[model samples]
Target: METIQFIHSGWAYIVLIVLVIATFNALIKFFGNKEFDAKDFRISLFTLITMHIQLLFGIILWFTKGYFDEMSVGEVMKNDAVRKLAVEHPATMLIAVALVTIGYSKHKKKLVSKPKFKVLAIFYTIALALVLYMIPWNQWF
Candidate 1:
């Protein structure tokens, strides 16, 4: 459980870096009217892959922590920190991942460079915002 937690925590850095890179890349390219090529595709794919890996580790950590077993929903909800960890964090992260997945899928369907970058820019930016918001700063530092 500790190992899983450690991995989840550590992998979050990778996810963040990749997500930032991907989001910025999309935004820059879209605004600059640059062509979407293999490098762009690879970056986006890598971002998706890293996020999914982190999500998997997070799910394992959540289950191993036994949050639900330890507290009733009401009890969990009543505590802000507990609520954040047990419910809000996971839920928000799940939505973020979904957004990234959707962005990747949508970008793939676009035949033009600008539209692909635009789709990726919008979705990845929103997802990155959520991820930044949900991360536990105190615990991490």
Candidate 2:
């Protein structure tokens, strides 16, 4: 459990950095009317892979948490700390991940360069905001 937690925590940094890079790259390229080239594709793919890795680690961490045999759902939710970790954090993060996934796929479907960047920029920016919001600040670093 500790190992899983540590992995999740440590992997989050890579996820964050890659996400930031991907989001900014998209936004800048979109505004500059630059072509979506190999570098852009690679960065977005890297961010997706990093986040998915963290997601897997987090799921393992959650399973090891013993939420199944312990307190009632209502009881868990009533406690602010528990609710944030067990419910809010995961829920919000999942949404953020979905946003990134959507952005990646949507951009791929766009035949035009500027539209592809626009799709990436909007989706990634939204996802980045959600991820940043969901991070457990005090417990995390």
Candidate 3:
């Protein structure tokens, strides 16, 4: 369980860095009127992959903790920290990953560069925001 938690925490750095890079890349290219190329595709794909991997680790860690095994849903919910860790963070991250997935799929379906970048920028930005918000910054060390 500790190992899984450590892995999840460590992998979060990669997820965050790649997400930032991908989001900024899209935003810059979209506004700068640059063509989306292979590099752009690769970065977005990498971000998606990393995020999914992190999500997997997180889910594993969550189960390993077994919060519900010891406490009721209401008990978990009443405790702010526990609720944030067991519910809010995971749920938000799931939605963020879903957003990234949707954005990637939508971009691929677009025929033009601007639309692709636009889609990526919009979706990645929102996902990034949610990720940033839900992250347990106090426990990240």
Candidate 4:
């Protein structure tokens, strides 16, 4: 369980870095009217992959932790910190991951550079915000 937590924690950094890079890249390219090239595709794909991997690690960690086994749903909900760690974080992170997946899929369907970048920019930025909001900053740092 500790090993899983450690991996999840470490992988989160990569997920965050790639997500930021992908979001910023898309935003810059979209605003600048720059053509979407192979590099852009690669970066977006890499970001998606990293996020999915992090999600997998997080799920493993969550199960290993057996958070619900320690407390009832009411108890978990009543405690702010416990609620954040046990429920809010996972739920928000899942939503963020879903956003990334949807963004990547939508971008792939767009034929033009602007539309692709625009889709990526909007979705990734929102996803990044969610990720940033839900991260257990105090625990990680």
lDDT of 3: 0.96
Q: Give the per-residue lDDT of model 3 (tens digit) for 29-110.
A: 9999998899999999999999989989988999999999999999999999999999999999999999999999999999
lDDT string for model 4 (13-75, tens) is 899999999999999999999999999999999999999999999888888888789899999
Off by over 4 Å in 3: none
Q: Which stretches of candidate 2 lie over 4 Å from their true place?
A: none
Return the TM-score for candidate 2, rounded to 2 decimals: 0.97
RMSD of each candidate relative to the true structure = 0.6, 0.8, 0.5, 0.6
The per-model lDDT (C-alpha) reads: 0.96, 0.90, 0.96, 0.95
lDDT (Cα) of model 4: 0.95
What lDDT, from 0 to 1, does candidate 2 have? 0.90
Please provide, for model 2 over 1-141, each residue's C-alpha lDDT reduced to its tens digit, 9 standing for 90 to 100: 888898899899899999999999999999999988899899988988888788888878888997645889989989999989998999999998888888999988999889999999999999999999999989998
Q: What lDDT would candidate 1 get against the real structure?
A: 0.96
TM-score, cand. 1: 0.99
Q: Is candidate 2 or 4 superior in lDDT?
A: 4
